[model samples]
Target: MTIQVFLPSQFTAPEIFPVIRDSFGTFSEIPTEVDFEFSNLRFVRPSGIVFLSNVARYLHRSGCRVTFSGMRRETNCIRFLDDSKFFEQHIGQAICEGSSPRSTTQPLREVRHEQSHNWLRSTLIPWLSISSQVPEHDLYNVQTCISEIFNNINDHSSQDVGSIFAQWYPNERRVIISVADFGQGIPNAVRTVEGELSDPLAITRAFDNEFSSKSTPRNRGVGLFDLKQNVVGRFGGRVTVHSLGGAVEFRNVDGSVNTSTYNVNGYCPGTLIDIELSTDRIEITNGERESFTWI
Candidate 1:
């Protein structure tokens, strides 16, 4: 399920270009070859090969694996590729060949969430008509679960600095959603009140029934607590937390516990909330989920 590009010698000049970097965790791994039985390659002359190499490098950094396939073609193309590299570190790299084109001229769309939980409210409103079971009630429960987590993020994590990405798979009867942030993490959030504290201790307090670090509000901060209920008590799913150098997992009806910090990194500096909803009852904030009802 990948593509590779080959390069000839003309495209291998080290002094010809500058290095490029990418954020958004897109460029992390470079694949020597693809894993699919059948694959596609773009044959290019020296110039094309250079273009392909830059493109492959760009994609490779963007969590994509790309290979170069042809390099021994004509010198004119190579000359063009080489000439272009002289002026820019990442000339053609800014735009990947055969990659999704950017519409700089197009306007961006905006979504608003006025006091509404960002994820659930936007997802459930449209999935109502496609559910074969639970329907409204199931949607409500899912919304509640999504709301609790989103609210926790809003209240505890940094705003506009985090993002939530969701995908619903009707054919597979699964919905996966992840909310992540790049801000002060759980341990740091707690230290604002309890001074310096150990990662394990901070994580343990997060679920200690009567523990909370919210100085402004007096509620036990039931958002995480309630989210755990929906995952374990209601649906046959699991809940996991990876932060402050520790990892915790809450099992289903089996009431088992799995804890490990063997290789846990420093405070997440961000949070990732992942949920899998398997019931046919499908509930979402936006109508987008209904698109797959035919499956």
Candidate 2:
């Protein structure tokens, strides 16, 4: 069978999940030729980039012949996708002659699980240090957020690799990154402990400070509590976690940060985390930062 999936025009967390859940989520049942149409793509963020790329990968791995269509039609989004190296990373070669590692953007990248730490230490942090002028030591909170994410992928993703993309907005003094892994999912993992909660509830529970972690000794993670602290409390940015058929968004509204959850169009097969950090608010702490104590 042949399947044609129309990607959303506004490609963000809200827009992409339904397309993912309806088509990519059920690809294996038919597993024939699949074409992902990009003509309708109007706006895109880090979430769209990582999700589309990873979904293509998942399809390919499952023995389906996958093709991307509609690139010939030109739009600003087309230019952004090319410059971000999205097409190149997806197809294993440059789709357009490109200039990258720009002051405002870091092109799409794939990080395998075992090399997560080194990628952080050697590549990502250094580039972040240079681009944002935030210094390496001051980026530990950022590191903690991503490290905990990687540790989550290691323990729950059921896959050895994940993908990441980042964009910097100096005028806004913030950087946004999205990471994805094709594994079970936050809802699936948290359900093992919480037992049969809804996707949104399970995901919310995982981030709650009172929740207990079940990771192995080799992969210790305090779950999303610390991630929330680093991103919202420390860096003054928003963090959104999307998994299964639900998503939870945490951001500052007025002077207080609040949590909210809702369901999306379909289940996200793996976990995709969107992290926003305020570059102007980078802080270098003295001694050790306090860890959240489980209640």
Candidate 3:
């Protein structure tokens, strides 16, 4: 199981609270009241310690024992009266095993904008190179989806200084691409620009039609919205966003939306987007039966 902590980075607490809660429920199934232990810890900012400590207190009151395997250094622990877990022990295995050594590199600013583009180009070109063997329609759609996600990170997540560290597990046909920064998360950014948006699900709604952070000269009105439309509506895939104290799941089959809010242990920043593409779908692309790459 994974324990995620969300704190204000660029986004405010209220805005991201619902997002975090939704995510927490999505990842876990409510079990009977008992002591539960988890090995994974994900923290965004140091301020998240307050929220986590509060969670520990609440869990104790509920007669549920919650023990975190590790703490995230990025989180603020000073606010907490007691240290809960070792920050590195649990996550070290997941990070080491899932990550690709070559994938770790310089920050986004160090590389030219085109460098990012080229990174994607390299990942996509090989697939396109074997276009003759694959269905052109599927290739077009998959490329579009990947481009939408990559462009979103470059445009919004990168900001002035940031980096994209992603690890793609070709075996499982799963890609975990994380665009992190000391910048504001999506929820907080939206709240600042749009006067009090009471909808705690604003971040989830952003994936729906017409929801965007851009105010002026909103042209095309595509990208993320289109990505959702194609991925869920067309391809049978799932989209998840872990930010604040909530998690939002966009299920593709029936266009169903699931949301929940739960208390996380610490303040964490930025966003980590994980996409699960079917092996059956990936095989239909390019020449091989099972092959995938990330830019």
My TM-score estimates for the predictions, one after another, are: 0.50, 0.90, 0.49
lDDT of 2 by residue, 17-123 (tens): 77766765654485688898888888989888898888888888888888888874357787788888877776766554553445677678878878988888887
**Candidate whose lDDT is highest:** 2
Clashes of 2: 3
lDDT of 3 by residue, 1-295 (tens): 3334433333222333444455444223433232222223232322232223333333444445454433233333311112222122212222222222232111111122445556555644244324223454445555555555555555565343233333334455443333333335556656766665433365565566656676542424465666656555555666555454334556655554334433333333444344444434433544333232321
- Per-residue alpha-carbon lDDT of candidate 1 for residues 140-196, written as tens digits (9 for 90 to 100): 656665665555555575343334334345566655544444335566666777777
lDDT of each: 0.41, 0.78, 0.41
* Per-residue lDDT value at 214 in model 2: 73
The superposed Cα distance between candidate 1 and the true structure at residue 108, in angstroms, equals 14
Predict model 3's lDDT versus the native: 0.41
Evaluation by lDDT, superior candidate among 2 and 3: 2
Q: Candidate 2: which pairs clash?
A: 157-183, 244-267, 244-268
lDDT computed for candidate 1: 0.41
Candidate 3: segments with Cα more than 4 A from true spot: 1-114, 124-138, 154-178, 198-200, 217-219, 254-265, 282-295
Q: Give residue 248's lDDT in candidate 2 (0 to 100).
A: 91
lDDT measured at residue 28 in model 1 versus the true structure, 0 to 100: 37
